[model samples]
Target: MKRFALAAALVVLATVPLWVGSTYYVNIASQILFYAVFALAVNVLAGYAGLVSLGHAGLFGIAAYAAAKIMTSGHGHLAVAAGALAVTLAAAAVFAVLALRGTGLGFVMITVALGQIVWGVAYRWISLTNGDNGITISGRPSPFGLSLASPRGFYWATLAVFLLAVASMAVFVASPFGASVRGTRDQPRRMNALGYHVWMIRFLAFVLSGFWTGVAGLLYLYYNQFVSPQAVTLTASAEALLMVISGGTATLLGPITGAALVVVMKNVASAYIERWNFVLGAIFVAIVVFMPEGLVPGVARLVRRSPLR
Candidate 1:
């Protein structure tokens, strides 16, 4: 049954552009895909490792900015992307080392400070980032002779990447390293006593999280064709975090569901409602109040307890 449901969901996702009947909706779907990836990246640490970070947008923006800077300087699209990922991974390593100095709230605060530093640099680095004007890429990459110039093409490309990322994450979470990370999350002292090297497991998890976040950043840059300090803001990180929490941390589909809700509210709802932010906030509050475990797990729990079941 689960396999059938998964196959059905994939079919629906693959056919979204064909059925949506509008470029705007296709682009929105792309946004949801990349943002869902970002939220999943957050969930890697927050859910699995029990290390909640509030500065992942900084890592996300770093790759976007790196790609933009390289592409604008006449580098090849492939090279620019590779460079962006490399830079993001390096930054993530640094962040992990520093953030791991403290556990729980301390780690969160450290990430916040680190994120602010990135934001300040992006805002003030006018020479490279163009400051408030932002840097815009002139064209999209045509990988393997396939052009992503059209909206449908872009959406397909984004979907492909999203699937690869999801598969990789699924594998990661099922691996021994994933078990170690979860062990560390649930009982660091026990894991440490068992010779698991808790800190190392966490450090690696943080870096892995950064890697996926960087992938999302690269996709965001491609989708928007622009990079700016706005992408690195605290609000962006907070939003991604909210998506993770609202969707149910530790679950594969949770972040994606949350991302869909948040993206729809931000893009579709905002168009029809002037107080969309208020509405989104209210909905988030309701999710917290009613479905404290998150929409996915909460629904699953109810289903399990249902008389019909």
Candidate 2:
């Protein structure tokens, strides 16, 4: 039944553009998918490794900036993407090293500091990032003779990428290494006594998180055709973390569900309500109070206890 429901959900996601008449809604859906990828990336550390980073947006934005700079310089899409990933991975490695030097609140603080540096550079580096003006891509890529310029084309491409990311994450979280990560999270002393290098596990998971975040960054750049310091802000990182927590950390479906809720609130509800942030804050508080395990796990628990069930 779970598998059937997952398949049905995937089918509905793939066919969203066909049924959703408005281009606006399609774009919103696209945004949700990409952001879901971002949230999933964050979840790798926060959920499985028990490492919550407050600065991953720095890694995410760096990829976009790198890709934008290269693409704007007239490079091919593949080359530009490769450059972006390379830069992002290097930055991620550095971040992991520095942030892992501390644990608990210390780790969180180090990430915040590192993320601030990235945001500062992006905001102040006038020549490369164009400062407040932003860097605009020439256009969407045409890969293997298939153009992604059209709304439907881009939406389908996003779906493909999102699905691939999801499958990859599923494999990662189910593997032996993933189990080691969870072990380190729940019982670091025991794992260390068992000859497991807990720090290495956490480091690898952080880098892996960066890799997925980079992919989401590329998709974001393509979707907006622009990259700016705004994308690198701490707020972005916080929101992604919020999605993971709100949906249910350590669960595959949680980030996606949370992303859908957030994207809808930001895009749809804001249009009708002036004090959307207040409403969103209230919702977050309510989620924390009423569904402390997150919406996904909390609701599942409710369903399992329901008389109808």
Candidate 3:
């Protein structure tokens, strides 16, 4: 009953742009969806698998570049999207192979290095990425002869993908593979003693996280009609980490809520405050100091106490 109610609420929320009738609202909605997807991808690593990654922007940027390049070459077809997914997953696999060999700070360093390398490639590869100037695909491609350039059109498309991704992640978190990954996270030595390959599990989790991040990147490329090296910078990566942490690291829906709040707050704050980052930092500190488990968990506790659960 609760789940059904939640679904209905989401459907109503998804239709807000139609009622609001404003392009700005539509744009903000699109951004919320995009960042929600990005945050969810980060959740797979930090939430489910207990891995803190600061290089997701690398995967996100690479996938966006792949989509833009393919689209520019008159190949913005569904087939090209599939190819982009493949290439992004392949890059994830490579990163997994290299980073899974280490954990803790070593893993963090590896991801940081990977992000820097990707940023450099995107910036220096002028012919391919147009170097810093970025590439703008003329119009959004239709996956099945359906134009998605309009804000509302893109919003629905992105919402569908976001729903599907969330459902898939929910299923994955309840599956045996997810159980094993969690086990590896909690007690890797015990899992290894039981003959499980801990490193392999972590590597697979990394790849899955990358795949979802890639999908988000694809959506972002079409939504903004632009791709740039700055999108994959270390700051972007850190921002993702902040979202996951602030939202409640292990809660399934926490990152989405966190992303929405952060994005909306930043957008609102920048209009008035010159030092938005400082304000954001203060908010983060307060959240960390007051509600260490994140907003979602704290809200859940309050609801439980109110006889709502």
Candidate 4:
């Protein structure tokens, strides 16, 4: 029944552009789908692996810049992806080393510091990044031979990417290695005692998560056709963590749902209030204080106890 519900939800989301006549709504949906991918990437580390990162934006933003850089080189989509992958993997590997060396608050602090380093590079390196001016991707780059200049084409492309990312993550978490990683998360001491090589497991998880987020960054760059240092700052990193926590960690659908909810709320609230960031912060607080278990888990608990159940 839950599977059916999820399938139905997908159908609804996919057909949103069909029902909605406005291009604005279609663009909004595309943004949600991409952010969903980003959130899922964060979930891999924070949810299944019990690793909290505060510099996720650094990994993601690096890839976004890669996409932009690739575009200016007169390359095809595949070439752009390759460049993005190379840069992102290098960045991810470095971050994994730095992060895996620490644990708990120490790990989080390291991530924050590392993220700042990336941000600083983006800001100070005016020649490469264009500094505060941002990088412009004049026209949409074609994937294969298909041009996603239209809203519908881009929406479908984003959906396809989102589906692929979710499937990959689902398969990953159900594998034996994933179980071992989870073991490290749940019982690190026991796993270490059993020769689980906990540090390696954590490092692998971080790399995988960074790879996934790097893909999202590529999509994000294509969607916006711009990249700025501000996008990879501490605040952006915090947003990724919030998406995972608010949507329910350790669940495939949780991060995506959390992302959609956050995107929708931010868009809606920003129109009504001048202090929208305050509103966003308040919502985060409310989720942590009242819905610490996450909206999905909290709702599931109620469903299990209901008389109808």
Whole-model Cα lDDT per candidate?
0.94, 0.93, 0.86, 0.89
Q: How close is candidate 3 to the true structure, as a TM-score?
A: 0.95
Ranking by TM-score: 1, 2, 4, 3
For 133-207, candidate 2 gives per-residue lDDT tens digits of: 889887999887778898888888999989998999999988999999999999999999999999999999999
Worst lDDT run of 10 residues, candidate 3, spans: 138-147
Residue 89 shift from truth in candidate 1, angstroms:
0.3
Which residue pairs come into collision in candidate 4?
none
On lDDT, the stronger of 3 and 4 is 4
Q: In terms of lDDT, which candidate is strongest?
A: 1
Question: Tens-digit lDDT track for model 3 on 139-180?
Answer: 777656556877777788888898888888888889999899
Runs in model 3 lying further than 4 Å from the true structure: 305-309
Winner on TM-score between 2 and 4 is: 2
Error of 4 at 202 (Å): 1.1
Q: Which stretches of candidate 4 lie over 4 Å from their true place?
A: none
TM-score of every model?
0.99, 0.98, 0.95, 0.95
**Roughly what TM-score does model 2 have, to 2 decimal places?**
0.98
Better of 2 and 4 by lDDT: 2
Tell me which residue pairs clash in candidate 2. none
Name the candidate, 3 or 4, with the larger TM-score value.
Answer: 4
How high is the lDDT of residue 237 in model 1?
A: 93
